[model samples]
Target: MQVSNRIAIAWPLATTAMHERVDALRQGGEDVIDLSIAISHFPAPLPVRQAVAAALREPRLPYTAVGGAPELRAALAAKLRGENGIAATPAHVIATNGAKQAVYEALYVMTDPGERVIVLRPHWPAYAATARLLGLETVLVDQPDVIDAAFLATLPAARVLVVNNPHNPTGKVLTAGELAAVRDWLRATGTACLVDESYEKLVFDAVHLSLAACPDWEALGIVTVFSASQSHAMMGWRAGFAVAPQAWVSAMSTLQGPITAAVPALTQVAAAAAFGIGAVSELLADYRVRRDMVVALFAPVAWAAVAAPAAGPYLWCDIRALTFDTQGFAELLLQRYRVALMPGEALGCPGFIRIGFIADDEATLRRGVGAIITLGDSMARAAGGHACSA
Candidate 1:
């Protein structure tokens, strides 16, 4: 048997691979603390649960249009209008299994093979992975602290640009001004934009502004994707949708027909309920406390520097002072201390690590952080360096 060239060239997403390793260790009776990716400890919002329950009581769940049930898409369009400021109609909405699928399909329909796609570094692995799967040339640039006209001018021309608001790992939310810069850049470059706002509702300090919120959004050719996974703690539900120009939605729907017809009927129900319910205040409070605790714990550690992120569940730690080989450090930490984390190399950055502080309880979270500090201190001492303050 022979595998296709595309399959042979690609590797499993590093974040998922680490999570599977943790799952395997636990299954083998080895205790492991997983911080590779954020998985909320909370359950799906009650409204979402009730909506699915209501759907279950129906006589028979029939398939809807490939895009979504007309009503569901209408509701999602209203969400885009009221919540996101995007002027959308049912014709512009397409329900997807999750944000990942929406991203894959958007890139597929928007760009051809060998076309350039610009992705900011320290991004979600799926952005680069999906581009590779479709055989697009990915041009990676370092994510600037602030996105402005000057920074935008430095990027190479590309067919599409992928933007993650309230970004992964670091949780840096793009401000309204930053979003304006992006919109202006997109207009000037005539480059299509794919904005992933999956973490919009996870915000803590700053507000999330959608790049497609402007009046010229359709003219700009922007596709904004949303997911229930992070916002409503509905990871396993795999409910998400994309808001695009009507033609783009039709193209994505055509591609989706042969792949996965429509999102499961129940998932569309959950999504309608999930996005309607605003921020999960209780869950946000819990995550805020955890985020602060992790930042405070790392404050005294000389070898690591972590800031309180504006949004999202992961903490990005800079460990370049200790070593640049974060991959090796992460591997040895998992082997020696039984703690799992994402090495920055996987996210297009080195000498850093991303810790997800949302999954485990406080005690377990503390223990995991302690183990990491202990290992780093040991490594520093062995290298004849000063001990970590922690």
Candidate 2:
């Protein structure tokens, strides 16, 4: 049997090694503190869990409408309009297994094989990998200071561009002005965009501007994706939705009908409940406290400098001063320190690492970060004070 060339060349999902090591340590009876993945440590809001339980008892748990459960779509549309300033109706919504699928389906509908897909680095690896799997070419560009003429000149004739705000790994929320510039660039280049706003409520000191909220967003060809995974601590539920132009959404629905059939019936009901319960503010409060805890813990560490993440649940540490190479540092920390972190090499930056702060209790976070501090000191000493930055 032969595998496709796409499968042969694609890089494995970067977190796979982290998960495997964590499991190995647990099996060996070693205490492991994981900060690699961004899953919330908190439980699902009581109301949403109760809703899912109740929904399970109902007998109507069959395949739903291909786009989504109608009520959930309506609820999502209302939330997008009321909170995120994205003017959407149920007619323009398509629910998916998760925000990842929402993004993939949007790409599937809006782009074609052999078309160029532009992604800014450092980025979630899935963005580029998914494009490759779909027979699309990925053009990776260093995230620039501005979408100016020079930056525009470097882009290929791209079909879809991926943007993640309250961005992963770095956690910097894209400001309104930045979004405006992106909108202008998209229009000028005749490109469509898939903006992942999964961390919509997770912004800390900055505001999250949705591309779909841009004036004349439809004309600019933007698709905005939101997920209950982060907002409601429903990662296992795999419930999310996307808002795009009606025609594009219809096309996605048609594709989804044959692909996934529908997102789980009961999960959709729970998602609708999640939107109505209004518990996100409380969850955000917890994450905010945790974020602050991380800042205080790492503030005085000389081997590495920590920037308070402007949004999301991560702390992006510039570890170049500790070690010029991050993957080596991350592996050493995992094996010797029993702490897991995301190396920036996984996200296309080589001198940093991302720590997800919301996935562990304060005591565990303190301990994990303490280990990282120790490892940094050791690595810095090993490097003999020779280090560099990105």
Measured by TM-score, the strongest candidate is 1
lDDT of 2 by residue, 1-390 (tens): 999886887767787568677879899999999898777888888888888888788777777899987788898899888888888899989888888898888988888899989888888877877887788988888887445556666777788888888787677777777777777778888899999888877777877668888568887789988888877888889988899999999999988888788888877887888777654788888888888877787777776778777777778788776666899988888889789999998888889898888776789888888888877766666868633222
Clashes of each: 0, 0
TM-score of 2: 0.93
Residue 204 of model 2, lDDT score? 71
Cα lDDT listed for each candidate: 0.93, 0.82
Question: Which ten contiguous residues of candidate 2 have the minimum total lDDT?
Answer: 381-390
Please estimate how well model 1 matches the true structure, expressed as its whole-model Cα lDDT. 0.93
Tell me the lDDT of model 1 at 282. 99
Candidate number with greatest lDDT:
1
